[model samples]
Target: MPRTVAPARRHSARSRRLRLTAAFAVLVAVAGYLTVQYVTGGTSSDQCTVESADGSAGDGRTYRMSSEQAANAATISAVGTTRGMPERAVTIALATALQESGLRNIEHGDRDSLGLFQQRPSQGWGTEKQILDPVYSAGQFYEHLAEVPGYSRLPLTVAAQRVQRSGFPQAYAKHEPDAALLAAALTGRTPASLNCEPPRSTAGTGGMTKVRAALVRSFGKDVLPATDGAGAETPAAGAAAGALSVPVDTPLRSGKGGTAQRGWELAHWAVAQSEALGIDEVAYAGKTWESGSGWRTERKESGTTSIRIQLAR
Candidate 1:
């Protein structure tokens, strides 16, 4: 009457292995989610809900970007790249300040330094007014960086210091890792990666932000896009197939010549960085032009590098 019971089957090696694999996968996912939250300023999942495709003003209100500041950031990053500085350089520059100045057009710094890159005016950097100007400040940093022998090959801190000359040289080093991450996103070298949910359109700066959004659209949303190389011509202005569809007047690019062309220079430069940096296209003055899938690069015979973001014409 006391009938014997059968023993339960044990898990085979394969079953145990599967369980372990699943556990590892879950741990990895949880870790990744936490990382994104911390890096994005501990943003709530709800905060970044507005998808980039919806495109109105964006979640910009939370981050406090005016359209103007956003536009300027896009333009400046584009200019830096088209001029032939590496993506690492741009990210390092952007991150140094993202850590130090939070990307504002800052007017103050340690002692007498100022602007995004925080170059000090007291050290023969430039006048207060000049350092505060983003374009000028960025250019100055680039100029000094270019002077460092083999700078491109040097460590980020060493290369940045060749320009920054900061008292806290080590401080610049920590920023390098983050800067490298951002460089991929901001430079269009990584596409889809450099995105933010700054304050929505209504609350942020206006004019420039719209321009930046258009630029992102014209360029690929991701570092690479299907259309990137097809229509995104490699016409190097004077090159055989590189010439623009419309005839360009020589005077347009001169001090007294290329009026709109001058602005277009900035626009195209941004587009040229489409591939390696993820710039898909640039839109300005009512026209949208595509970009090459190759870092949106261009080096003119005249020693000038250029890019353009056509407006939605």
Candidate 2:
């Protein structure tokens, strides 16, 4: 009186278990791939490149980042430049953001921390809304960094740690090279230096008004032409509804180059914002950068005193 199990039944159960285990392993692998894709903003093929326009191709220095990170980085640099902070400060801020949130305006982080800087609300960085605003968060970081004595002279890690008080203090050093490149291009120290190849799926229908508003928001209204009878055409009149021409009026100084540098800054900023604002073409300093096609030189009778941004219609 003992019950006997069939060999066929035992084999069938073992085969089913093996099949299930293999399926589960496949599922886990797919999930991990997807998570990484989401975190890195999909494939690495689409990227923003920052280089030295004046340097030889063999210079062997370039900074690459996702389009999203480039946008946030540009905003941070603009905030610092607009506030009259030096390029070094912008570099420090960019590095801090790179370490904290990878330059994404994230909504959640360790505990109640949020935004690009990962400032915690409980610690009075700001309320959730303020902390989430990249502009506000960048400003707050600068305000605190300025308080640190001789921050510019201190080692980057020491200076940033004084402001951020991050647990991993050494991490900031790793991002310095990329931060310097971004700071150079965004702060207008490099010409025709930053280019972004936005994903085709994210392109937007063009609007010049939004472009103008965005320029004001980042660089301040002073960057805009005076509305009252100035020699330059109004932002609305010089171009059609879908096109905008921004005049570069930063006064040229002896031995400091000419308006060309300022033109490049506005031009590069427009390119950086192309994805977010749905821009299609940006032309300045006799060079034009299309959404898909990188930068190219073109001769135009109109000269390089203003940057032309054409949005999709």
Candidate 3:
């Protein structure tokens, strides 16, 4: 056979082998990229980072999230806390959503499932539009989760599976560590733990009106007082135009943390919404987060009880 092989045949076979090898390499590269994206949440410009609850960043215990994922997670935490659900409940809900939708409010899933939690309207989760709304869907999830007997005491997977009834019940367990980190930051138990990068564009539709509306939508009307013009509590005196101050002194009925905790909660929420809300800076508890700079210590100690949200003009 070696003696019978022609030069042209040999070249053709070699070319075919080369093409096949190159194609395989490309396939592997694409697969690797997708797997990384799925695991890291995103590698795009609009990304977010959440450090550990203790505020240690050098330990390699951070969780990276896409801007979309951060925003959805913030909504989930807000919905739960405003409903008086504890941090554990928030952790369970977040883990469930991560497994079901990777924290994305998707429009498609297995057999008519939809939205972040992949609730199926056919199963009476909600109408398509309702299921698609993050706030509503999260609320529905919490409502279901609250009904589970001793959900707080159960294992995270057990609590989540009781609500989701997923074919893969154990899937939620793997996400617990990451979910706990997110819940800690978003729930305000971990101060300055969450930070997001500046958006690519600030020219989108934005204003304090939109910001106030988003806050009320996620944390409920109580998130902002009925006064201060847009349901935001009284603005601080001498504040600049487009600056909105959210007072955190008002105690939450069953919410976790004290005033400082609430302040950080609002601060982190603003950072998570920065890209979409056109926020330029967020200051709370003597720490400040600028659009491009992330978080910096304004002082070691201060009496700041309200979160100041500065919007880009």
- The candidate maximizing lDDT is 3
Ranking of predictions according to lDDT:
3, 2, 1
Error of 1 at 213 (Å): 14
All candidates' lDDT scores?
0.46, 0.79, 0.82
In model 3, where do residues sit more than 4 Å from their true spots? 1-46, 54-57, 228-238, 253-256, 299-302
Runs off by more than 4 Å, candidate 2? 1-45, 54-56, 226-237, 250-258
* Of candidates 3 and 1, the better by lDDT: 3
RMSD values for the candidates in order, in angstroms, are: 20.0, 10.6, 10.2
Q: What is the lDDT of residue 11 in candidate 3?
A: 100
TM-score for predicted model 2 compared with the true structure: 0.79
Residue 30 deviation, candidate 3, in Å?
22
For model 2, how many clashes? 1
As for lDDT, the candidate ahead, 1 or 2, is 2
- What pairs collide in candidate 3? none
TM-score per candidate, chains pooled: 0.46, 0.79, 0.82
Pairwise TM-score winner, candidates 1 and 2: 2
